[model samples]
Target: MREFPQISYAFAYGSGVFPQTDGSASRPAMSPHPNPPEAILKWQKGGGKMIDFIFATKFTQHFHSLNLNRHRDHYSFLGSFGSSIISHVQDDWGAGAYFNPYITVNGTLIKYGVVNFKTLLRDLSDWDTLYLAGRLHKPVKILTEDPNIRVANQRNLLAAVRCSLLLLPPTFTERQLYTTIASLSYQGDPRMSLGSENPNKVTNIITHQIRNFRMLYHDLIMSLPNVDYGEARALQQGWMEDLKLDRPMAQDMDPAFRGNMVRRLPKSFRQKLYFLYQRKFGISGREFEGMLEASADEDAKGGLKKPVGGPFDRRVAAETDLREMVLKCVNQTVKWPSATQSLKSALTAGPSRTLRYLKEKREKGRENALCDGTIVALLGDEGNESMDSSENTTEDG
Candidate 1:
């Protein structure tokens, strides 16, 4: 195992930690191939994609200072500015992360990002910047663990589920649900628009890591009173199972339920949603905030306390534009941070390495576009009809 300085939390993700592929659902059993998976084998041999890591540290300056002393080559010209400046840039800059890409460790090319633990936790819980929070939405290989992050990430996952549900139709397939959930962070990401990322990135992630997604969300899905499965037994056994809406859309149509969903969203996101709500519907922000505060107070009481729906709840239920409002909120929340992070990466990774990374990404995007377009075209109108029929049936149910 590779050695590194002590850190609060660390994890590996990206194509290195988890290989990206399609058609996993239809993949043949290993017996026919009788060989180890190419991706896994390559990773084990340290010859595939560069392993990506994120390290969360208690003190940003101290950690960078130590890391700089140990691996001075990991940093670009920024090392000349001293650790204090590097730490300041990391904490105050885009998404509170500083990445050093194209570094070779133990003869294996690796890219690692450093972040302050406090920033990571806050973003996980409140989405102050969806940067790190977005990464945690997908599966990762944990190298080190912190209890606080584990708990905060649970809340993050729950918020993702609720957000996806609001944006989805009354009825959706398991694949569709996971796809939507996985696509949350990329909603307004500039990379997707600029062709710097795979057009089918979300689909690729869902197809490749469906089982991992299932493992992450299974227990949470089971606990939700509003959602039900067409095959509960199979679902409980960790198999792909159809989702049957318990009501119009997996939850009561009452404003209370939707309001509660909004209540539980990340703090920064919820605040943005509130702003959108007021802008579009002209609702009083004070009243909405008050209801949220009251609901939170009740929740803080811990024991069973019945929630009484207020005017804000009714307003949320009555608003025909709630879905659009949510979409706008998400887009706004993701847009700035994502753009800023890309710019910040240029400095941290240096111009030469940044150009190399962009070239690789663009090539990958081109390949993915060709593949994804064909797949979508093959699915054709049948997929749309199915979704339409499901929605109609759900509305009637």
Candidate 2:
């Protein structure tokens, strides 16, 4: 992939890179086949898994134009319209990404998405859309690295922690925290709600890759001023068991602190919050700007620099409608992008490929549902058996 033209940033993610076991229960059992040992080994290692990649280039049009000459088969009929048209479609729609799926490279199946580097930066720093930022919230294998992207992604990861903290209760298990963080991207995604995606997708990812999550977030979590582990545990594998938030942070009703958190959110999202807050509270634009300035005027020590305070900031922080406002902002940012990207994938992948992809996804979804049901039934039976044993012991007594 390093040989791929002008890819300033690239990464591989999904089950192919970070293997997950929970989905194995849902996967079909392999049928017996007569094959040479080497071929069988290769199939066992890589078959049926699609390695996913996202490539960000300096100029999307230039990259596509070059790619057109080199690998024209990667494009659908849309490729006939020329690189300029393809670039326009990619930049103007669907979270500013164009994906080409079901392509084979070096005898391995792969799917890659291309997006302009600038748009990728904006999404990371400003949360203009959670489309890519949400993906960064999870663990990934960074194939190509850009210094600027690394900084922006740090902000993205911190923002995810802050948002998850706000949504979570005072005392929560590590699982709860990670799940809330993971759920950020899927909040308004159509595939999740429409049942085309596996319901246990997030849980499975976290359950199998807790160490990966710790690697990504542990240090960032420690850096937070308001969050801490409930107990001092030995530094070993799986130490992220319990988390405790400061009393005020847990209640999250502190106007000043909450206001700071809201302000620190991505610029685009903060702007949306401003408009929503104004509409709900009937404040003027000037007043909102003043409150924003006050929130931003904080020192390295987290203390107010000037203390130009107002009730507006307090109201934004302590209002019961705060959670609703945040959700509305996220949905506004994610809902359209998620849907449009799905549509774009269909066009970019072509009819036969799109159908094959959807069929594979739906099959996984159905299998997950059945596996979940079986687990629930087994748990229920165990509960009944325990109750019956207790009753027999009491009678004997």
Candidate 3:
């Protein structure tokens, strides 16, 4: 893409995208580890990490063939075969994302994933892998994008807001909404329990990119129906704790609410979700009761629990069934990256090197996370950058 504009979409995300600047974005959250003052934590993709980038094209095979020929060594042993093989594996075996790992650009360790425009749209619109969707949830500089794709992403943002609202309590603060949005990808990831990810990763992501999240979801917040979102229109530019969802909020998260949410999601997801329901609940044909049941966590009509933390603890929300369904889907999405990475590593470096590759990735994540979390500042060079479980690196395995 740097050489030509043949690709449909591309962008630079992570600390590598920007030159070294003051770490002020993260500095404010440095007071303490667990709870910080007015902390607008960085919610996704740690700073000074590997420069993560993704490219999507309408012509997958053609684009891959050209790029593979141009940078054969980047694909490890697989490039020697052909782009068709790589593309096949990426689509058939993986979650529609293929990466060229540890690529050296100006001595910088960078990795870029490639997926077709169709897969990108599906994943973005649906919360399938929540992979690319999770990354886009954070602020990333766009190198190139299609206008249609931009519109699709806006819909994705709206979906994010609505879904987060569904997952939240009857009354919530603006930070709660943003935090819920930030935690979407990590809700049920196996990696979160492994300590492979930083405990404060989500907090850091939202704190650092607070302004960006505000800009993205503010409109959706304003448009929410039947709720008291009027406080968002106050003198402040972003969401505030003053905002509250009325008692009717419980009714809003009904069967129709879930149907609307499903309709807005990508077709691929809708298909998979429907199949899951059919297989488990015998919900065949047009019956969507199973899906609605999954979306309707029990209402807070009983009584509001004492405030625990941001966005109301999952328990306090009283949506055990919905949360269970969420964990099932999110965990289902998290499983694919590991299998694909293992397959790719085995193909590239033989089965032996696969272990080494995974070991190295884990070590790098821990090492990078050890750096100061106070700011999403730029690293001096690529050598210092590392990718976290939040995005690019440390996703799984």
Taking all chains together, each candidate's TM-score versus the true structure is 0.80, 0.81, 0.66
Tell me, by lDDT, which candidate is best.
2
RMSD in angstroms between candidate 2 and the native structure over all alpha carbons? 12.3
Q: RMSD of candidate 3 to the true fold?
A: 11.9
Rank candidates by lDDT, best first.
Answer: 2, 1, 3
At residue 257, candidate 1 shows an lDDT of: 70
lDDT of each: 0.69, 0.71, 0.54
lDDT of 1 by residue, 205-303 (tens): 776667767667766766666665554454344243322322122444566676677666787787777666666666676766675566552366576
User: 1-397, model 2: which lDDT tens digit per residue?
Assistant: 4235777887666765555553334443331333424433333343346667789999989999999888899988889988999999899989999988877654446688999999999999889889999988887766667779888888898899877776766677666788889889988999988878888888777876676686677777767666776655524454544223211223344667666676667778877877897888887878777766655646668785653325665567777777777888888989999999899888888898899989987876764432211100111243224323321011111
Q: Which segments of model 1 are wrong by more than 4 Å?
A: 22-41, 44-47, 236-251, 284-310, 369-397
How well is each residue in 1-397 modelled by candidate 3, as lDDT tens digits? 3443277776566544432223433422222224322211341222323456788889877887888767776666777778788778777665677776666553334557787888878778666677677777666666565666676677677767756665665566656677878777676554566654656667666655555555566566556552344342443533333333211222254444444554444444444544554565554554555444333323347542332122112222233354455446556665675446446646654444456656755654464233332223222222123221122211111
Query: What TM-score does structure 3 among the candidates reach?
Result: 0.66
